[model samples]
Target: MPRMLDVSNDVRAEIGDEEADRLLAGDNAPGAYDCTSCRTPGNTEQELTSTVLFVGQETAVLAFAHATCVPSQVVPVSEDQLRGAVRSITGEDTAPSYAPPVPAAAHAAAPHFPAPAAPPAYPAPAPSPASPATASHTSAPSSHAPVPQQAVLGVTSGVVLVGREACPALVVEPTAPIVRPGSPGHGDEFLQLLSEQGFAPVVDLSRPPAPNPGWSVLLAMGRLHAVLMPAPGGGRPVAWWQAHSPMPLSEGWRGAVGRTRKVLIYAAAAGTIGTQPREDQLRAALDRAAARGALVGASMPLAGT
Candidate 1:
């Protein structure tokens, strides 16, 4: 059986003519699939399907989409994001985006802190309260009530697979095992602390929730430069982690993130996933944490550097 396919030169250059021909012959391609871009149904036998490649530091994921929804192109992503996508496709447990129940006594026992100084200006329009539904496409920051910080989070960039799909993801590893700001002897409670405040642990990225206000990942010239934290009091996005110099990203990473306004974010309890060229190592570390239920995640829009 023959199928209508639009394999771009770039894809052809990477996958080669033999594979491309195989796809057109319906020997290797799927009959129907969810469009990588729109997440809607697509039939390769009925309509033209674009061959999209998601390239990361260590792996490449080939996905299909409607020609109208997404032109064939290579997307770059982090290992963590790719793993999440894989989970979604593989039917792994996807945590609910809603905040989990917290004991009233726990909240009552929480220590109080002084109000932070007035915050700075966020990028565009103010953001709205988070909903587990669709992500907000607006460039504006969220307007939710401000949340205070206790520990600093260290972030790394990579791609993850939801299933056979791939997308860019940010991996957050704390500089130190997270403890309350004033407490010096507290144990690692980073993921637990965020969970208590409504941040959910995401094992799958197929149906991620809208990002909470103030968190963003910045890419420039195909390099990851900073991870912006929400400013105190709903203020501007500030760099929670900025490279001493702009760090180059894996091939196609910036483009992958550019094509998709959304990016997945994963956080571990504490520990360095290592550095570049070792993204695979980082992926393994985070994977262990995720397996042990020590990870939290979200999908946020890309922000300017």
Candidate 2:
């Protein structure tokens, strides 16, 4: 005789009709399912059976029973959650039907920062250095305008604010680090952010000296660029930029900036640009930079600016 198991609503939610049928048919001897209530397993000893009775086009009653064990009350789950369960059973890529609630402690720990303010008005271009009167007199083009200087802060030992003015970017204490990569907390936050941004970051196993820790950006400008690290044997260190194409920076300025710039841009883009250059205008400036071929290590095709 097959073993009978009692499953809660939560377990039933996780193990859809297909898997439940398989389990009742003796396909999975040792398996688990999750539902709103809790996780359930099919490891008990007794004859098992399952049946799906439809209530309507969108609703159904799933029943499971053991030959010797009494069945519990059935529970209702949303159609979307049921679909997700089916995907889970079929081994397909589907978002989970449920997410654990956020802890209040986490909300209290990190206070959310507000958005950034607008940038200052465009400043007048500086005068060019005078050429010797004795040298050949040639007319310089008046159409050329000086590129606005943008200050970028670099964070090595700690966080540095970038842009024309300093702003609250990220808190990075070299002395008291809470979680590093691969840690439970770190992986959770990383995966959450990645999913939100629709990006899949690849881990680089290359040596430390390699440019930008082997980090590459897929810019919206229809190009790929590598983020270079600070130079070795350095004097007045600077990060290097190489373009995969001559695409406009405005189209994908996010991929051009270093880690600090990327973070700031993301913050601003997420309606959090602080009281300096407004987020929209700052993005515009970045776009202009891309248009002028300022992005480093980019050599891909340029698209809409």
lDDT of each: 0.52, 0.25
Candidate 2, residue 84: the lDDT equals 36
Q: In lDDT terms, which candidate is top?
A: 1
Off by over 4 Å in 2: 5-37, 46-71, 93-305
lDDT, candidate 2, 55-103, per-residue tens: 1125443333221222333322224333333443333532222211111
Taking all chains together, each candidate's TM-score versus the true structure is 0.45, 0.18
Off by over 4 Å in 1: 1-154, 196-198, 205-210, 271-285
Candidate 1 per-residue lDDT, tens place, 212-250, comes to 565666543233444566655664455544443334444
Give candidate 1's error at residue 4 in angstroms. Answer: 35
